[model samples]
Target: MTAHPDRTAEGVWDLTVATPIGRIKAVVEFRRRDGALTGVASGAGEDVPLRDIAVDGTLVTWKQSVTKPLRLNLAFAVDVRGDTLEGTSRAGRLPASKVTGTRRTTPARTAE
Candidate 1:
């Protein structure tokens, strides 16, 4: 079997969005397993577990939920380009919020 190379979205990313309440921040990390994608979105006083993660080319989608301040579940659809990610997070029937951020570069790995 042939192994594919890593993509731009397969690393820790620092994301932010401006909302009516205030500017929110989240750290998202993604990884691929057996042709499937999985990740976590954490911030805003809570850590959220992502679900239904899917990746296609430069596009990625996932679902995350929070239960603090309120019970809310968000669906994310983002396009990864270079070191930037831009997209929206939809909550039910409400309008999607603007989501944008830059990818965080990780330190070089050392041989064991």
Candidate 2:
């Protein structure tokens, strides 16, 4: 069953995040289980689970740490409009960078 557009952020999202090095691409998957929201991001040969995921209206926020290409802790705040998302990611005390993402029409599959 499809989730409500305004209430749920459960889906796979393709994200383009800007960093000091360059623009990196990642896929994030959000899920709602047992009344809690959880997510994971896959990129740069790393798949890390999102922390402190909170959703309010269309606004979603989460924290993640990555250790490939660079090691940094990231905090994300995005506004979800339908299938698209726009926001910023901040690394420690550095300036925030633009972050844009779109919900994937087809969920990614693993090789079996």
Candidate 3:
């Protein structure tokens, strides 16, 4: 079988959100496993786990749970181009907020 490109390359994502309070920034680190994406978000002094990552061509979608007494679910979509990623995020709740971000290169390995 032909070898697929390694998806486990770690990368950094810089996100901007337009909230009622104001615009907020979030930096997320993502890693891939067998073509599935997984990562963590660094926001509000916490590292939150990411899930439900899907990649279709240049489009990517994933869910991030923001649980700090109050549970908030955030869904994101990004477009991958070359070594960069650009996308938007929205809340699972009604009247969703819009978020945008960029992904940059990080460290990578051959295997986990």
Candidate 4:
């Protein structure tokens, strides 16, 4: 697993989720401050806040509240290859589903 130098100590991650609801894509922005992770989920008219984001190596876990007063417990074990992130996402108490996502690549910067 490779880490991106451009990846913020905390930042947003765009993910694609495969569900019975079809393929839903969202941007989950995370901030690591004082060993706590916090962020928001943006997709399907849902901008839900994420709580208790935790990262152990390449594995990430968090909780997101749905609009219907329900919450999803998500777990992702990501392997970074270049600009792509391959992983699995499991929602709530269901079994994990295969997921693959790419990070939006930005142009390399030149030293000023």
Candidate 5:
């Protein structure tokens, strides 16, 4: 059976990227479409669409742009294992930075 969005890897990810300056926390969300992935990655108050999204086995790759800190694009490839995501992020042609994140848990809805 296909996994539901509520209980699958195709949901919100709270990620942190390790840079020479410091660690930056970001948020991303993934949705599976026809066995492929499409989503938005948010950083520095900008929500950019995930481009060139590719999935192989348990690994996924995507890219987005950052406008606040500077004008640069980031490419990310991550391996999803259980509830943890391990991966690297690349900014332009610079060396890749370590990226890690965990799936965010949704609280149960309370009926009013």
Candidate 6:
């Protein structure tokens, strides 16, 4: 069975994440392949696949490692609400950074 679009984090999202150096803007795309939740985050001229993606109801969490401006192992936990998501990301002992994202919407195609 297919999950409802609003209830699932299976779409493209624009994310703004706060970091010690500065705020990093990224785009994350979530997908379900072979009944498994998977995702990828692209930012800072790098595209990295997310690991350990877990979803429960409207809560989604994943781990990602980014190497571009710098290298850091990140863990993300977020709550999806309709078209928006709010969450936090932590890197080791560093303070958690606020993560906010909006689902990207595509215009509906009309038959000619």
lDDT of each: 0.76, 0.89, 0.68, 0.62, 0.80, 0.87
Order the candidates by lDDT, highest first — what do you get? 2, 6, 5, 1, 3, 4
Best by lDDT: 2
What TM-score would each prediction reach against the true structure? 0.80, 0.90, 0.69, 0.64, 0.82, 0.87
Report the lDDT tens digits of candidate 6 across residue range 37-64: 7889988888899999888878899999
- Please give the clash total of every predicted structure, in order: 0, 0, 0, 0, 0, 0
- Which ranges in model 1 have alpha carbons more than 4 Å from their true place? 1-8, 107-112
Candidate 5 lDDT trough over 10 residues, lowest sum: 1-10
* Candidate rank order under TM-score: 2, 6, 5, 1, 3, 4
lDDT for model 6 comes to 0.87
| Highest TM-score model number | 2
Report residue 36 deviation for candidate 2 (angstroms). 0.9
User: RMSD of model 3, in Å?
Assistant: 5.2
> Taking the tens digit of each residue's C-alpha lDDT, what string does model 4 give over 16-44?
87776677777766655565666777776
| Span of 10 residues, lowest total lDDT, candidate 3 | 1-10
lDDT of 6 at 73: 96
Winner on lDDT between 1 and 2 is 2
Worst 10 residues of 2 by lDDT: 1-10
In TM-score terms, candidate 3 sits at: 0.69
Better of 1 and 4 by TM-score: 1
lDDT by residue (1-86, candidate 1, tens digit) is 32233454777889886555656788888777786666777786776778988767777788988775557788888888878989
